[model samples]
Target chain A: MSEEHAVPAARLRTRGLHLAYGDASIIEDMNLCFPDAQVTAIVGPNGCGKSTLLAGLARLHAPRGGAVLLDGKDIHRLPTREVARRVALLPQDTQAPEGMTVSELIRFGRQPHQGWLRQWSDEDRDIVAHALAVADLQQLAQRSLDSMSGGQRQRAWIAMAIAQQTPLLLLDEPTSALDLGHQLEVFELIRRQAHTGTTVIMVVHDLASACRFADNLVAMHAGRVIAQGPPDRIITPELIRELYGVECTLLADPVTGTPILAGVRRA
Target chain B: MTNAGSTRAGLGVTFCGAGIALAIVCLASLLIGAGNTGADLALATLLGQSSNEEARFVVYELRLPRMLMGLAAGAALGVAGALLQAVTRNPLAEPGLLGVSAGSGLAVAIAIALGSSATTLRISVAQLGALAGCLCVLAAARTRGVGSDPIRLVLAGAAFSGLLFALTSLLLLLDQRTADEIRFWLVGSIAGRSMDQVTAILPSMALAAVLILLVIRSLAALALGERTAVGLGHRPELVRLTVVVAVALLVGATTAVAGPIAFIGLVVPFAARALAGSDIRRALWLCLPLGPLTVIGADILSRVVVQPSELPLGVLTAMLGAPVLVAVVRANRLPSL
Candidate 1:
């Protein structure tokens, strides 16, 4: 391709990444790049390494080989505080101490920017307030997380990540165990975040929703990426069968034109 | 933001209230004692008036040292307890129950057996033992099933403490002549400790205070779990180790001067959290005054409850702390560590 026609490089890239728990290797020789300002979903069945890959990217799990690059440098080598300022991760399950108000929980996100010499500042306060507003938690800011509903609690957690004000956001099943309505609520927030020019990457269990919400979809099976592209182009009946070992048909959503899974049965 | 600012101000007010309570309790500790010299006489002596020799001696020599000892020991135990609970993420975690104090007791017992009577060396030896004990509890918590579950960690601690207690008893049986010296360390008390003993432990307490200030922020972040703490630019393992060292120093210093006063760590942290929410940072701030307040209150109560002969300060704290422990476990939901 001509130089001008070449696509810009992704903000986050994995160069032959390898990960393992003890002696059992999970992801091996994986190379992928998640472009900036897009919602990228990593979808797979059980025993796949989607969540593990995300953990490696977030530096929660160190890779055994190669590197995870943020912008153009190796992320592992960067100072921890600098890395936190550039990326934020929200695992599937998170907890706050008892009786901690929503505002208090969100305030913890400013830890990277805070020190003994410099505690609370106007910018920190403004960002935390902005995070609460974006998460629709302005009214519940004073309420304790324990008193909130499942949906509200989840939103509060996302608000904490939002308060970090990172350009890259990573979530592991951000809506798991929530009802359909709550799922949509969280996904809408994630979508809004992505629309604001943040690169949002999430490990999504539901392929249909992943296709519906994400700008790009990465499909993995048995620790390797099998397909990746725009959801409309990457998702197919054969790909679903290969990933899940189930017979299924793919259909386009009437309203959004995103790929949707229809009839399915055991193969 | 305005609401948050107000909430913070409310916390500041709570801390001030606790400080005032501490001052009142310290005065009470100075004024009241189990002796012929009454509170009126002690107050007269404190007011710079010419009082009888007995009253001046009682307030200056006896009550003054004891109250100062209570303040230092109380603050140490309370802060140590809070640090243990925060690092383990178990509200029930206490130095006394987790064998830290028992560890100090055993070390002192060994020291007495070895004929090391120097007060300064005893403090160091006790602190070293307490460090070992803190490490043991942490090791137990790190074991697979025990680390994550609060009750299981407590159970492991209880078991470890029982082992240390048994070893200490064995040391007592082996050395009969040193029984008098070891007896005081076993059943902790604030009485009869000279100013020299208090001075000896002050250095360790100061060191612990510095360490706590350094790690308190990271300990708060750890409440969100280890991964979240790491994600926030904190080194979770390093924070946990620093907390353990700080706990060992505090517990050792307290045990050195006042014996292994039971439950001050547990009760102090419990009360601090109650008065100032669950954040370790806030709880620790409250712990400063609340520890001395609770310890001195218990010390005064120990003197008054049994006239002519004071109860061991450790005994009173245990009586007050055990119920709170049960109440915490039975409260349907234990506060997240």
Candidate 2:
């Protein structure tokens, strides 16, 4: 709760965004505002369209009826590279070419800012170095991604996103496959990134971790936002039952004072 | 930071070493041959020391042009292989194996069957065939289950190649007058080909080179999966289309001159990736040298192996490349691109 707050600006927002895969509508008439320089987590159960919304926000998925606005203009209408400069996304399935060093992978983040004639500038080098440091991966810069452990590999991926230096970062289940320690390693890194005034939006699977890490939570079910606010204000037994069909007691973290779900049972 | 610098320096050293090796191979290609002229005589002729007329003719007219063609064809096939593998994200995706070479070969066979002997027209026909083949391979790669499985995609390509080769053979059977020419060309050799044929395809190769330079960075981004590439501000569709066209041009040009040399495309990029790792930019640089080295080395071996009757350049490359292909497939795991 002691994290310093920046003047929040809703640079990214959806106006009646409708997304579908052919005839199957995933997210319909979705309206949401993602606060700048803050960490917001989208948490929902299976088939809830959280990832679809993330894709729409990142412009990977086109809106069916409405629009995703970036800085008051339709995101789809802006030049791709121009949108890329302002937003970066780390999708759930991240794979790098074999034998790619951490630094080489991170250097890809600077592609948007580079051109055919202007490659590997001093500025690009500096930003990559800064990203490595920020992700605590300086020592592993030359190490291949395949050689690293799970936590270190995830950090390297995060470092690549950091090197983009975009104001908004969206991650889909960044800690999905990692162990608890590695999960913390990534969550802390995301927190540090948010502290530096980058808007961090991620689709998190674990409600407890989402409550602990995200400043705001958007809970969804069947392509609808059932609840949206701070975790402490929006989380309740009824909301938990609605989202996951589980009834649980909400407890408080002893030190951080964040909401923690305990004693859960199937509704 | 220092580690990165050291790696960069190491790459430079490796690149220079490959370049020197390619130069040696080029020299060997020029020196050793199936004729009466020996390496010493060819060297003397090259240095303008001896006026041996036979050595001069063999070196200048026969060996020199063949070596140049080998270099150009080798580089093109090597680069084409690397580009194909990178874009398809499949290590086994090769010009020869994936029907691209066969595509061009069939085009030329069709041309030869129709009684067309013009060199420029043949090159254009071959390129057009290569473009078609390239599109077919990409289409197979985009299919639901086939695209995700590298081996399945290769299987599809092999089937397509077999069909094309059968069609080419059928054409040869139907046309007896063009049969000898088509048969000789079908075996794939660089002997007796002139410098003019090599020069004819230069414009297309040059254009392909320009396209590659433009998309090299984007292609590298593509190796990280499509969504990530899109997230990085690159148009993955555009990059894929450009790479397919570039691969077609390179493979088509090489086939036009070399009669569908196989396995150099596969082996050269494999070795380059081994030496330079998987970064396409670095692997591509190594491919430039390694490709020519492999082709020229094979060409030299082909000359000395059979003496009076030289081995076909295509046959020699297949002999060399097939084992590497087996080795790669037999490895514990196919290295993911």
Candidate 3:
């Protein structure tokens, strides 16, 4: 996206990142960079630490070994609010108080920019309106999120991240609980945002969908990246077999010219 | 579950209507007192057909101050309850249940046992104790994963309150005279209170007002949960700190003035949430008016129901507040915050 926009890119780099829970190490010396304005999908099996890697990037999880640097400074060194302003993260499972409207949930995306004195501003209003419209949530804004269908609620949550207006937004399994249509709806929203120059990093289980939607894919296995690059290069059958421990054939999606996983039986 | 919007409006209008009813009860209050100086002569004096000196003393001097204290005490409990419930995001989270009042009560009991004859000083001590209790509970709630379980927090609160209350009872038992002095007060009644206690508590009440204003925004953010609250740039620690201080001050002041009234906080906030929807800010805002209304109204009920002898305000509040608590627990099934 930055290559097309011609704006100078600020790299998000994780150098020698190590994470552990008590005694067990989850990630070890993981050095990687999320290229600016690119939709990078971290794909792996359950407990492979793709979500953990995403959490480190969003500053939600503190690193045990090295630094997650946005530009040159360590993200942990920044104030939580400042990191929030620059990097917005949507955790896989988010909840709101009962009776909260869709609009109210999305408006919280403006949290980083809002303070007591500057509670209501024209800029905030515009951003909230735009987010709702972009997510096709305007008609449902006034409706209570708990009362809505799962797909509608997911869209509302996505709308909230969109409203944050940060260049770098990370989503952890945004499509985890959705049906096929709902997953496509969420994926399309991610794709559209990426097209508009926002850096969307998501953890996805579906490699085919990631290949179709993500501009770049970082395939992982056992807390390490197996490959990182464009889907056509990274989604090869050899890489897929290594990442998932399954044998599968990969071919071009005739429609989008993206890598398509044609057949899959567990190895 | 009750629709918080229409429920609040209904309660507001009902509580307001009850306020008018409270005025009539206040007149009944003016008509009677513990003073031996009054009888039917006070009634004629109040009606303006007669002005017996003894009747005037009974009505103006004795009954008026007691009536005023009841109103203030009830309002304080109600507001404190509403604040606790909103801030904690637990409908069952009343200050009394959380040991905030017991903390205050324990301090006053200790003060009484210490041979402190100074009433004004005991007020401050009670407030300090309430603040300590609030801090302990908040710390417990925020540490790591403990805050995640709402029911566990409520249970912790109940245990904390029971411990403090038990300690207070022990302190009272150590000194017979102090025990006699504190027994009715501990049970919570506005009987025999002087205007001096009311004057002593006004400033803390004012401070509580200001503190509530400052944290209302953060509490609203908190309703979205902690990470979201941090994401909004409002420090969750600061918000919790401010709320604890405000609740402590309010609970302390009411304890000082009324001697540890229970259930007004639980019921008032419960009712307010039923009316104002789930927005913490909106609930807090509505609680201001609703708190005093519920308290004063309850006080009036305490007066008329017993008629000749009169019941303790705390007893009535407990009776009303407990059923509301049962309803709240049953209403959500999941015990929603």
Candidate 4:
């Protein structure tokens, strides 16, 4: 409970961020500040630019205009390695190189902290150990990623990001490929990590799960943010209908009191 | 249980094992040639027990330079293959299949046809041609469908290689003396190449080695995927361009001295990955010893396989490497980068 209220007010802001691929602009004039140390879920229909916005925030895609600010400093102005030290991103569909063990994969997270003469150190070892513990993957540290189940592999990837020790983490549909049980496992882990003071932003397809797991929600349609607030405040029937072009019942989950969507139909 | 520390330590052991094997092969290369001098006489000559002038000449002048050439060429091809594979993120990507060495061979043929005999000049021209060829195959691979599908990229490379080989053959037909001087070279051999030829490619090799060191970590990050690599603070485009330049230098240097030795580039890196795992960083290090081991071993076998004359090193390597190439393709799950 003490850690729950201990969220640091580290700020990540975007000012009129614009993202494009060739001539097609995906996200245009985006302006927002991520809730510090809270799990923020960006939910949207297919190709609504949620993922593009995530990539822009993580500095994976250069913005066509404006800028992303980490702690009020323009992210683009910082050296790439310096930015990596502050932000870690887990893109969907990452494939570990053949025969890479979980621990070996996690070691790559330390790259920004290391150089030719500083390949590894006591701090790196400690951080990797802590990451494995946090992900509950200590037993699987030596196991090859190929030998793991989907849930286990997903956890391993998250552990790599955690080992990066960045204050901000961005995941693009991290649980997209998992089974229901595995998805819950990943979501719970993500929640627990966010509770520990790392600001988490994820692109989520499941609006119900977003409501259940995220503290703040950003709903988008057609490359623009349509609503942003607590999930309970923002996830209304009208919002659901507008985002998904579907009619649905909006009710609270009896167990958690978060909004839930049911009886969906094409609008 | 193999943790991060154990894996790093494991790579060190693999490197040492490959080094030992390389040393043994280098000794064998020095000892067992087609010359009348027996292994015992060669060993005696090596130990300075008997100062036979013929034995000294054969061992020091003849066998030694060939051994050095094989070592350098093997390492170059091995590292070049690893770098190319990583840049493409396709385990099957190789310079030989992708027309790099063929391009170098064609450049050398053109140089000879144009009446340029300066050994240093030939190496530079070959390197420039190799850079062009590497860039060409990479561009073809990047075209929409070919980038994701490994086999299609190889097909594109093979088609490009065929075109280059055809052009080289046309050059062979264009002139007789140039053809005579370049024919054996086109087939690829480590035989009778002077130490000067080995020395001539040194700067290029050193340049390649330096570039590889600079980019190894970024290349490893790249195996995770481009966006992931970029997120790790690496400039994927810059890393890829640097790797292409390094591959060009190494392959160009190898082709200039050994004459387009096929499959060494394919086989050496493949074997290194098998031993050292797929981290391009670790695999590149293991390639150092494994490359020389493969080339020197093949060179030794080449001398004995055809007694009076000798098999071309390229032919021997191709004979050994073709099966490996087939096996890599036939593997149920191609190792995804």
Off by over 4 Å in 1: A1-7, B1-6
Candidate closest to the true structure, highest lDDT: 2
Q: Model 3's CAPRI class?
A: acceptable
Model 4 ranges with Cα > 4 A deviation = A1-10, B1-6
Candidate 2 at residue A208, lDDT?
Answer: 91
- Per-residue lDDT for B52-91 in model 3, tens only? 7777766766677777776666567767776666566666
Ranking, lDDT, top scorer first = 2, 4, 1, 3
CAPRI verdict (incorrect, acceptable, medium, high) for model 1: medium
Cα RMSD for predicted model 1: 2.3
Residue lDDT tens for model 2, A121-200: 99999999999999999989888888899999999988999999999999999999999999999999999999999999
Residue pairs clashing, model 1: B89-B337
Candidate 4 at residue A23, lDDT?
A: 100
Q: Taking the tens digit of each residue's C-alpha lDDT, what string does model 2 give over B1-337?
A: 2222127777798889999998989998889988899989999999999999999999999999999988898899999999999989999999999999999999999998888989999888999999999999999999999887888988999999999999998998898977898888877777888989889889988999999998898899989989998899999989999998999888888888778999887898888888788889988998998888888888889988988878998888888888988898888998899
Least lDDT summed over 10 consecutive residues: which range in candidate 4 chain B? B1-10
**What level of docking quality does candidate 2 show?**
medium
The candidates' DockQ values read: 0.51, 0.60, 0.38, 0.60
- The residue-by-residue lDDT of candidate 4 on B1-337, one tens digit each, is 2333237677777778789889999999999988698899999999999889999989999999999999899889999998998899888889999899988888989999999988988899999999999999788767899988888899989999999989988988989999898987888899898999999888999999899899888999988888788778899878988999999999998898789988887888887787778788878888889888898899999999989678888899899999998999999988887
Q: Which of the two candidates, 2 or 3, achieves a greater TM-score against the reference?
A: 2
Question: In model 2, which regions exceed 4 Å deviation?
Answer: A1-8, B1-6
